[model samples]
Target chain A: MHKTLWREIKKEKNYLLAGKPVPRLLILNAGSRNHLIRCFLKSWAEQGEIIVSDSYPLAPSLYEDCRSFIIPFYKHKNYTEAILDLCEKQKVTGVLSLIDPDLSILSELKTEFASAGILAFISEEWIVKATFDKWEMFKVFEANHIPTVKSWADLSEFLNDVKNGKAGYPIMVKPREGSGSRGLHYIESEETLISVWNNAIEPMLIQRWIEGRELGADLYFDIYSGELIEFFIKEKLKMRAGETDKSVSLRDEKAENLLKRLSRNLALYGPIDVDLFITAHDDYLISEINPRFGGGYPHAYACEADYPGLILQNMQGKHLTEQKIKWQSGHYMMKFFDMVFIDDKTRRNAGEEIKQQEEN
Target chain B: MHKTLWREIKKEKNYLLAGKPVPRLLILNAGSRNHLIRCFLKSWAEQGEIIVSDSYPLAPSLYEDCRSFIIPFYKHKNYTEAILDLCEKQKVTGVLSLIDPDLSILSELKTEFASAGILAFISEEWIVKATFDKWEMFKVFEANHIPTVKSWADLSEFLNDVKNGKAGYPIMVKPREGSGSRGLHYIESEETLISVWNNAIEPMLIQRWIEGRELGADLYFDIYSGELIEFFIKEKLKMRAGETDKSVSLRDEKAENLLKRLSRNLALYGPIDVDLFITAHDDYLISEINPRFGGGYPHAYACEADYPGLILQNMQGKHLTEQKIKWQSGHYMMKFFDMVFIDDKTRRNAGEEIKQQEEN
Candidate 1:
């Protein structure tokens, strides 16, 4: 918290602008994010490079046509050290993660990472932690008058709302800190609600069920100005595994304004994806904000959102201009399955011992 | 259905023996099955050819480096005629569907398909329809003394069993004809059971909850012998979107015998995928049977099960000898995503009209 240390860290964050002609972006826990990694590689074509690090040696992205190596599991004692070493050795200028918990972990190590001249593309520590809890996030949105769905963490509050006819049955009950549709339930009546509440082993958050279209937004902001540069919106047509499987890009003034308001209230950094549901009244009720790249980022990249390119320019100390991003409005993104193959003889060149122990 | 037609169909099934050098294998509804199709193409390199057919032009498999075209949707009045016409034109000797409902549809048109010198690899029509209903399938299993999961379709029957202390709480409620986890609920109390039952729009089947390891078996039977040829077993390490994401090949004698018993109870032909649950007592309870290729089939292919090669050999009039399929055990199969780029101008050459109408 010293003033001198703060100044030094800020200077180191823009280290690439000093002299480096190319930037190496490290994607950690790059598990099946081959699509996102490919987008980075395509934009960085001959000027820069992309490096992937995952605890598992067989992560599909590791075997991609790029420099990849294994790192200790995120929970390991030497996890931070492994990343610091990789960044230093590979000359990585900016790093990002694909997992949620790792957002706070990476942000909390700002001093360590900044001192090494590597910028971790994550929000502040408290902001990242706040996004993890649904109840806390709902309160944050309500406090700022941001549009969000009605939620209740207390059983009595939910029952009182029902008694006063403020809410009705056919609601959602899910873990307070859940993601990707796991541990989520749809209660059609009071009987199911009571039974689910009594049988819960963890704190459950309840919300009014919205029967409308779901939207996923990928927002890109300027590093220095902290101004929204591009907001790519997509209407999720179908979902598989709680992730967007098929979507079509669109431009909605109402949704864009809500996202801008969210940015003003949170002061979040670059490249965050948000989930929202539009009611019949056309109100965009924000559900959650993932302060990291989501699975649907590729859709934006496919539509020429150019987020990776913009981030690289920012790391190079380039001031981005606000422009009318001319993205295609009716393009559809359809996702499918693909795979790679490797044998036992072809194994990791780094962190082999650590990976094996953690995998067991 | 006549004796003369039956005799003529039997003769036409062996049409490959009439001096045809390379037999063509057709895979219908080949959506995102690039992995499985690649296996077939690899084995048929110079000896045979692999053809793909689907109703949608943008199907990822249709864009692969192989002969692909779109047909009418399976529900079309000329669906069977279209497949027959394609088989006659492309010299396709063997045809197989990758969907459950299409099995009976293709098999019912046996005379038409056989007349075109194409053998559809599906079980008899009755058997394929039997697998669609969970309650009926359970009764079939019980009558045949096959090891299967206990199911209750009638609410009064379930209640009587509960009163008799034969059933307990923490059960499962799902659609009677469901597959792959949709509409499935884990009920922990009577209140939830009654509530979920009352709100059901369709018949929901109840089942005893089993806390055990889930396994997926890719069974390949001989075309002529009607005997199990190769049973590729994989323990599902993780699941995504109701499909196996990561699995490891394994050998379990108890489970193999149960699969063998299932083959006897139902004379399924060629390739079939079955799901099983292993209890603490090591009892392999058969859950459901998908009478077609499954998503986890690539795991079997990666382990060198070589079902595609075997099926091709059968089509070429080469009788396969019973041998121990030496697929490597303990090998892990992890799946990831990859994609291809196609602009609007590079649209499908065939079935574009049909595809657009259906997509709308």
Candidate 2:
């Protein structure tokens, strides 16, 4: 049981309340998330606007009829400067990031953005720091008594467990500090595991593989009211390129309470996604925390969970005192690819204009 | 070398030309090809209409604004009857299938469609059969003197090549009769090759691996005029899920001549895609033949290659004899995913409506 017309009420408090008319959201490093951009556009069209930035000029999200800026790469010395300059020039009222590595950067600059009248949609700095690292996240979950899959940072320890028959094949090797499925290996034997581990990138993690149906939760805590206002969950039916392409919505009271408990135990602000697994034994375990809008957020939005709309409410310094609407569950979301087709003349002119601006 | 727009005049002879007013083309098994459907819709808006049929109701392309039918799977006993009934009901004038395995099925039904005044945009049955199988395609390429990478269907022959220091590791093992990158194994050593070969699906092929920049060519041949009408080639720079996601336009005369020769030698009709790999030695080898539109067709269309329009022209019994105009090369095409977000009410209503029709 995931969505129930959002049973929520705003408490009597202010979260650094700053309401502005026609708020413009600065979506930094918006890499090819055209569908996500469209979702934001739909919810924010009447209330505010969206401004996108990316280091790559060809990022599809940058061409979504928004106020877009071509910024330097996050590692570039002038990257922060470019973002701040754009925010100032565009009079951006809110700031958020899409890429994982850039989340910590945004968290670090939360004060700067707030000083400039821009509310940064980031969790607390420590929470962001801990959640981005796999091992740290595991520890955080364990400390909070959250159901979590077992993981090991040291290879020898993982091997010891494997030899003891406590762990077995079809285990996962992933980057300790990375997001997405990049640098991830699913090993079925000790030989293959050793082969992958030997040639794998350093700072890797070996995790006990969880098999069964996976569930994705897209949750939101009202940054203004400082309360969890939105919770949505879906069982992943299909995955394409490491992102959920097909899912069916569900409601589970136990999972919902676990997530609410997680929020109470840790300071998770704005929109955060939780990856979870329901094992064959009918027990569940937490996998990872994406402290931003998840790729499968569309399923939730379609179910009227409306995180973007909730974020818009936060931008207005307004909170939903109570949710009275009802929406059906068991709705299936199927995702497919559309494209931004740029013509030759438009492309050259845009490139030339950007090049001239950089020169200036 | 590419994107030189129409310099062609209509040839005086008829090409079984059955030009009709407002022709409806049936796109069989229209899977989640939303962008492709959009392309066809844009080109055929003035000419006629697109009638889509898919075995899966959730195929996103079905929801596009067009006449669509939920047909039985191709292997189903009543599949041909359902297709024929849809053709009759929708008054479809042309028919094509997007998937590989269905091509031979469509080719076999060419006469039945033609007898009903509906054109099947398929090559001859032998051509379709030969091109869909890896080993058969290799033999065809060799027979036609087309540049091709050597492939072995027998394990002993491939092992002999490796032992004789001819073909080395880093080779490809692919299903003899499959499309796309499914069941493809990139073997890096003899041991890994043997290990994979032992457990792999039967009737597999061992192919020489050529590493360098890969080039995707989308070419269209007018079945009416019996001439190659459009050729678009791009250098693949990035890939996502074994499909080209980023590419830059390139013009290679040698490659063009090679493809044009292959088309003329074979009974290729309608559209075919050639996956070619450019070697560091400056020569290229044909990898496989996809006897329908390629995934990178959007790049070609962005460059004004206009295969959809060419196909429309075929339906119009009109053909371009020469080429003129030009679109600049080096223009890049980047593909991303957008979605069709259907509301729950609308979704269930559609499902129920389809169910009612099936019950009737």
Q: Which portions of model 2 miss their true places by more than 4 Å?
A: A1-22, A88-90, A150-212, A281-285, A316-326, A344-360, B1-22, B150-175, B182-206, B316-326, B343-360
Clashing pairs in 1: none
**What DockQ results do all the predictions give, each relative to the true complex?**
0.30, 0.41
lDDT of 1 by residue, B120-178 (tens): 78876767888888988888888888888888998889989999999998899999888
- How close is every model to the real structure, measured as TM-score? 0.76, 0.83
- Across residues A1-360, which tens digit of lDDT does each residue of candidate 2 receive? 111112111111122225424666889888888778888989886456777778787787766766566778899998787778777755678989998878888889988988998889988888899987899988898998898889988888888987898887788988888766788888888898888888875688888877677998988887755577778888887787788887778788767777777654577779998988888787888888888998878777777888788878877767654353344557777777666666556555545534644765
TM-score per model (chain B): 0.90, 0.88
Question: What is the DockQ of the complex in model 2?
Answer: 0.41
The number of the candidate with the highest DockQ is: 2
Provide candidate 2's TM-score on chain A: 0.86
Interface RMSD of candidate number 2 = 2.3
